[model samples]
Target chain A: MSSILKVQGINKHFGGLHALNNVNLDVEQGKVHAIIGPNGAGKSTLLNCFIGRLTPDTGTVDFDGTSLIGLKPHEINQTGVSRVFQTPEIFTELTLLENVMIPALAKRDGAFKPSLWSSMAGETEIRDQAMNALSEVNMGGKAGMTAASLSRGDKRRLELAMALVQNPKLLLLDEPTAGMARADTNATIDLLKTISGKGLTMVIIEHDMHVVFSLAEKISVLAQGTVIVEDLPEKIKGHPKVQEAYLGGAHL
Target chain B: MTVEQSKKDKIMVIGVVLAVLLGPIILNPFGAGYPDLLQKFVIYGIFAIGFNILFGLTGYLSFGHAAFLGVGSYSAVWMFKLLSMNIVPAIILAMVISGLFALLIGFIALRRSGIYFSILTLAFAQMSYNLAYSVLTPITNGETGLQILHGDPRVLDAAVEDGALPVTNLFGLNMNATADVSLLGMDIQFNAGYYICGLIMIVAFYIALRLFRSPFGMMLKAIKTNQNRLNFTGVNSRPYTLTAFVISGIYAGLAGGLLACTDPLAGAERMQWTASGEVVLMTILGGAGTMLGPILGAGVIKYFENIFSAYNESELMDVFSFLPHWLQELVVSVSSLFVGEGWHLTLGVLFMLIVIFLPGGLMEGFNRLVKLARGGYRKDGASASAAGKVTAE
Candidate 1:
């Protein structure tokens, strides 16, 4: 597969403490890549840097052959890279359908369309697409419900649907199943597997070992702001460094 | 229930339309006595609606919006003095100046959110008010306030007797014509000033309504709800917020200009921080985030401020003179507390009650009542639904 994303010599610092150190990775198009690490291992920091939320002190993230260093997060999203936040950041006051429709509306021709004397029905096709996205994530039944009413897992699912409606080329998932119950986590894993089957490239930062093992085609173990191992899941499971860091960290 | 709700809304719209149409006649029941109170309601309604656009939807408490209002009124009055007695130019200038002020203030205020943001706005407004009170005396006319002068320059419409445009016609209608029509035995006067203010209010309301639902508006809502998530999603919320602030500022400007047009005067008091606080009260009283709420809030407050406050003990005595000596005095004293200077105390208490008991303001309270009347009240456990709705916005 062709490489869709390339990260090189990524380094970040918070005052004197180094958050990320020389982190490098290449994500192939249509492949699911997972980044796993103990808490404080700079996994989120690396993802944030890629999406332009945080600028690395030394490094570059190139997505689809375009430099992402200076672009704003929204610009990066417009460029086909969308991030699903760890916390489901949905418009609480809006209904599920409205939340999905918001991002969809942003994709319409005019960024600022007159809402007065203009019916939302004008965007019937886009609305249907948003609804389809909801259904894809099994949130179709709750489409009319306010976003704040959703269960934690469902909220995450709704957020995923929002990103999917954007039809992004590179999707970043930050602990997608972080707060889900066992059943919900398994469902989320199944959902990710289904999406991966459809040829979408994904980079996921996950803490759940089961989820990380279930969906990731490639695993990268990060510890102390650096990638210690980049290998197949089986190889990662057997790697001594991965065992020493993640296993030891997990035990603690 | 839906049918009943629609009917209620329809009734409200009709009532408002009728009241506005026959405002002067109804206000001055004993002929042309004090129609000024009705005019104040419309003017302040415009102000509160503009203020609500920022504070209500965006969840930004701006304590300096009055500065924009003052800037607008001053600019408008200057326009009338320098150009023509016609209000078009003055109102337009007012909106433009207020919008500019908002742009500058918003840029500084938007740099911070929450309490810091509120303080920044307050400081800017206070600075403007102080400058108007002192340093900008030349333009602002100092403490005595600005009024139209008889010999003021009028380059645009100088009663060109030779071969120029006639008395500045606003949309081809002479502004000072006495055209009164009889409606339901009451003389309804369609004056230029009232129509101009009403037209501006309509336009402002339309623009606000559009902004409330637009993609840009949705983004502001996102910013209000979850700025961090919006950032991660790749949306720069600052520009969106600034744009909303500017739009709201323009609305306040229009209201300020209308105020000047009605009275042909502008005062430094227009930009006081207390005026800013008044709009906040208006928004909370009428229900923030509701389109008609702020307008309703403004009307209510203006009614109390102008009409209720005008009443003294004599007015109460005139109403209940049939009572005995001691009881009549007692009635007048009690009535005085509810109206006039003491009205603000009632406003403050009412505002607090709404904030505590009806946090959603009049709109939410009305919504609940409608639901209850329709037998759609949910069970006790269903409070989750309402809680969810509240948190979502």
Candidate 2:
């Protein structure tokens, strides 16, 4: 498979602390890839660097063969790379449909026009597209409901729907099932299966072993900012370095 | 999609149209200089509505909006003195100039958020105010204010026609004469200026409504709620916010132009920080993010400022004329403390109370009353529905 994302020699430092040191990652197109590590691992920092939330002191990242260094977060998003925060960063004040519609509207060609006025039904098309996106996660029924009222799992699902609406080329989810209940975690795993079935490229950071094993075709074990092992989940399960770095915390 | 929903929408539209058409007439029945106050209310209401679009919806607190208002007033007055007495051209010029000024200010202020943006706007407004009062005296006419001179040039519509200008009114509507009739023993008279303001306010209101429903508005709200998320979602929030700021500044300019048209004067006081603060109060008191809230807030504030501030001991005595001498005297003496100049004190108290107990402003109180009257099984839920979403952990 062709490489959709390539990270080369990325190093980040916070004063005396080396948060990420010479980390390298490459994601193939249309594959479900998971990154797992201990709490202090640089999983989130790596994700942030990809989305331009934080710039690495030294290194480069390329998305779809385009260099992503020095780009703003929004510019990175515009380049077909989208991320979901650990804590579902959905717009709580807006309706679920509106929450989805916002990203959808941004993706449309004439999103920047000042005087663009559409009829109520035409606006409904935006909502319909949002609903269609939601339907992928089986959340279409909650379209008109306020996003704040949704359960944690539902909010996560809604965030997924919002990301899906953008039709991004690479979706990065940071600890997507971190705070989910056991049932919700399994449901998220199912949702990931559904998403990956569509041949969409995804990079997920998950601590949940059940979820990672259920969805990831390949797993990368990270410790203290650098990748220690990259192998199939079955091989990673038995790797000595992976066990020493992550096995104690894997129950989470 | 439902019949009831469609009917409710129809009612809302009709109610809005009626209010726009007959607001001045219905609000001031006694007419005791109330029409003038009503006009001021509507004009300022339009201004506040525009201001709310930026501050309320976008979570931006601008301290330089009055600069736009002042610029509009100055431009309008200059137009009247140099070109024509007609308000349309003056207002258009005012809006355009204000928008241009906003574009400049927004570019700088939008580089920062929170307190930095506030201070930047304040510094810019203060600079403009000082320039207008001193350095720009040749154009602004200085502290003495700008006025229409008798020998000023007349261009286009200002030209005398058929020995005299053909009795021009707002949009050619007969204002000084209405159906050539009388109502309730008083001649029903309207000024071309009043109609012009009403028409402009209607346009402003419509524009505000369109903006509220637009995708840009949605993005603005998102920016307010979560800037980081919006940035990651591929929206350049700076440009979006700058555009909103410019649009709001134009609205403020239009209001200022209308004021100059009514009074034929533009003064440096219009650009004062206090004036900017007044619009902020109006937006907050009316319900910042709501559509009709700022208008209601402006009406309330202006009513107190103009109508209530004008009431004196004599007016109080006249109101209590039917009462006995001692009671009238007592009433007058007591009421004197709360009238005239005391009106600001009353407003200050009201503003403090609203901010303390009703942070959502008059809209929250009104929504609560509406919920109480509805008396349904979901009454408890309904009251909290319109209140801002309480933070959920």
Instruction: Assess each model's interface with DockQ, reporting 2 decimals per model.
Output: 0.29, 0.32
lDDT of 2 by residue, B1-393 (tens): 223434554565466567756664566454532446656877898899899999877999998899999999999888877776666778889999999999999999999999999999999999999999999999898999988665666575555534532332344453232332355555444545555666777677767766776777788888888887777777778888989999999999999888887777899889989899899999999899987789889988987787678889999999989999999999889878778989888898899999998899998888778767988535433433332132110
Per-candidate count of clashing residue pairs (backbone under 3 Å): 5, 0
TM-scores, all models, native as reference: 0.88, 0.90
lDDT of 1 by residue, B215-323 (tens): 5666767777777666656566777778889988988888888777777778999999999888888888999988788887887787667666777878889988999
Off by over 4 Å in 2: A110-116, A119-121, A247-252, B1-10, B30-33, B157-189, B314-335, B377-393
Score candidate 2 by lDDT: 0.80
> Which residue pairs show collisions in model 2?
none
Candidate 2 chain B — worst ten consecutive residues by lDDT sum?
B384-393
lDDT of each: 0.79, 0.80
Candidate No. with top DockQ: 2
